[model samples]
Target: MGKFNRQLVNEIKKEKEQESAQLKLREKYEVPEDVMIVEKDNMIKFSVRIIATLIKITIGIIIFLLTVVGIVSLVFPETRNELIFQLSNTLMQLKKFLNI
Candidate 1:
C-alpha cells in the first residue's frame, strides 16, 4: 500500500507539472508587425472621419442660422423688404469692391 501511495503521489506531481506548462504557454501573447501598422492606419482614418464630421456639423450650423434669420425677416414684412434691399446693396458693393 505504501508503494502504491508513492506511485500515486508521483503521478499527481507529473500531472501538476504538465498543467503548469500548459498555463505558461497560454499566457504567452504576441502582436504581429502588420497588426501595429493596421492599427495606425485605422487611427488616421478615424481622425479624418472625425474632422469631416466636424466640418459637416459646422456647415449645418451656419445654414440653420441663415434659415432662422430669413424666417425672422419674412415674419415681419418691413424687415423682409429691408433685408432684401440691404442684401442686394451689400452684394453690389462687394462686386464693385472686387471689381468683378
Candidate 2:
C-alpha cells in the first residue's frame, strides 16, 4: 500500500510538471500589441455621437417649450380674443382682395 501511494504521488507530480511546461509554452507564444489608435478613434466617434444626440435633445426641448408657451398664450381670454380678431380681419381682407 505504501508503494502504491508513492507511485500515485510521483504520477501526479509528473502530470503537474507537464501541465506547467505547456502553460509556459503557451505564454511564450502569445504576445501583446498596441491598440491605442483604434481605441482613440472609437472614443472620439462615441463622443461625437453623444454630443450630436445631446444637441438634438436640446433642440427638441426648446421646440417643445416654445410650443407649450404658444399654447399657454393662446389659452388666455385676452390673447385668444385678439388672435381671433386678427384672423377675422385677415380673412375679411382676403375676401375683399378676391372680390368674394
Candidate 3:
C-alpha cells in the first residue's frame, strides 16, 4: 500500500513474529539459577529482558534522532542559526533553573 513493497512488509512481520515466539519460548524454558528456589524465574527473566531491551531501544532511537537533527542543522545555514538560537535559549533557561 502507498507504493510500499509488500514483500519487505511481510518479511518484517515474519521477523517480528519470530522474535515474539522466541521470547515466549524463553519464558517457557529458561532456567537462570541452580537452586530453582525463586518462583516464576522464567517470567521474571523475560520481563526484565523485555524492559531492558525496550529501554535500550528507546535510548538508541533518541540518539539517532538527535544525530539526524544535528546533521540537518549543519547542512542548512538557516536551520543551523535557528537551532543554535533556540538551543542556546533552552540551555540558558535550564542553566538558570539548575542554578548553574
RMSD to truth, every model = 17.8, 17.9, 11.5
Clashes of 3: 0
Query: Estimated TM-score per prediction?
Result: 0.48, 0.38, 0.50
Instruction: In angstroms, give how far residue 92 of model 2 lies from its true place.
Output: 21
TM-score of 3: 0.50
Q: Find the candidate with the highest lDDT and give its number.
A: 3
Q: Whose TM-score is higher: candidate 1's or candidate 2's?
A: 1
Candidate 1, residue 32: the lDDT equals 36
Q: Which ranges in model 1 have alpha carbons more than 4 Å from their true place?
A: 1-41, 98-100
Give one digit per residue, the lDDT tens place, for model 3 in 1-100. Answer: 3787989999999989866666666676784433232234688899999999999999999999999999999899999999999999999999999999
Candidate 3 at residue 19, lDDT? Answer: 67
Query: Model 1, 1-100: lDDT tens per residue?
Result: 3456888899999989866655554555343333321123588889999999999999999999999988999999999899999999999999999999
lDDT against the true structure, each candidate: 0.80, 0.78, 0.83
Error of 3 at 12 (Å): 32
Record all residue pairs in model 3 with backbone atoms less than 3 Å apart, i.e. clashing.
none
Candidate structures ordered by TM-score, highest first? 3, 1, 2
Best model number under TM-score: 3
Candidate 3 ranges beyond 4 A from true positions: 1-41, 94-100
Candidate 2, residues 1-100, lDDT tens digits: the string is: 3456888899999989866666665566653332111113588889999999999999999999989967976999888788789889999999999999
Clashes of each: 0, 0, 0
